[model samples]
Target: MKLFDFNKYFPDEKACRKAFKEMRDREGVVCQHCGSHDVVWLESKQQYQCKHCRHRTTLRSGTVMHGSKLPFMYWFIAMHLLTATKKSISAAELQRQLGHKRYQRLVTKQEHP
Candidate 1:
């Protein structure tokens, strides 16, 4: 078995989209509203819909990226960096590396004030 690399391959929306589509298809997408396989793509927003209940869900919905303003590549890079290190990197370090001020503030508020 070969380990998949995100930085070496998926570094953009197109790659992420292709991988997500394949994975979603393989695992099958369940409607967030009705838990049905009958779904449609919303296109402009990169979301899926439940034909039975008309519920729309995003690619990042229920995912780690849910409610994030960061780009898809940011998550990929962060994961790759985290796995490459041994001693464990702090959120401050990760935030500085990724240059995400939002997360920086988020972690800061969570830890201190």
Candidate 2:
């Protein structure tokens, strides 16, 4: 898809988050603490509560975005660019495209976790 279409599909942070949650739901969420698959989404808290253990897990807990402070849109955009592009794009180029002020933060977020 084109950049315009990508932007239209993910117009805001909420849209991106909702999309992520839908994908996660399809794959199913397993409780990290109790090792159970009985999890339900808590819309008010934006987390999953394990029915068996009562443990709360954030949407990003086991995903690529885990422990990262960047917005969901950033991850979506980065994924789109990385997969859609014919040529390999550098991290610096991605940072510039995202209009992020610091490259170190992006590198740290991508590399550390």
Candidate 3:
């Protein structure tokens, strides 16, 4: 999607989180700890609690941004830019477009994996 379309769909962190939660729920959240599909949404904690094992799976768990400090919006925007461009988008260009002073981690993440 274009930047405008992406912004329209996911305007903020909350929107992105909600979308992510809905997508995960639609796909069904399996308990990584016990291999069970009996999971409950813990809205307060923004995680999935495995009914069988009681293990909490975070919204970002098993996602590309799991351990990243950057916001979901950043990742979403980065994804859009990376895919929308006809030519390759370099990490430096992406960092510049993101207007982040310290974007080494974001760039490195995109590069390594």
Deviating ranges (above 4 Å) for candidate 1: 1-6, 20-28, 40-45, 102-113
Which runs of model 3 end up more than 4 angstroms from their true locations? 107-113
- Please state every model's RMSD to the true fold in angstroms: 5.3, 2.1, 3.1
The numbered model that scores best in TM-score is 2
Supply the global lDDT for candidate 3: 0.82
Whole-model lDDT values for every prediction: 0.69, 0.89, 0.82
TM-score of each: 0.67, 0.90, 0.84
In order of listing, the candidates' clash counts read 0, 0, 0
Tell me the tens digit of each residue's lDDT in model 1 across 62-103: 666666655666666677678877789988888888887766
- The prediction achieving the highest lDDT against the true structure is 2
Name the regions of candidate 2 deviating beyond 4 angstroms. 108-113
lDDT over C-alpha atoms for residue 61 of model 2: 86
Residue 25 alpha-carbon offset, candidate 1, angstroms: 4.4
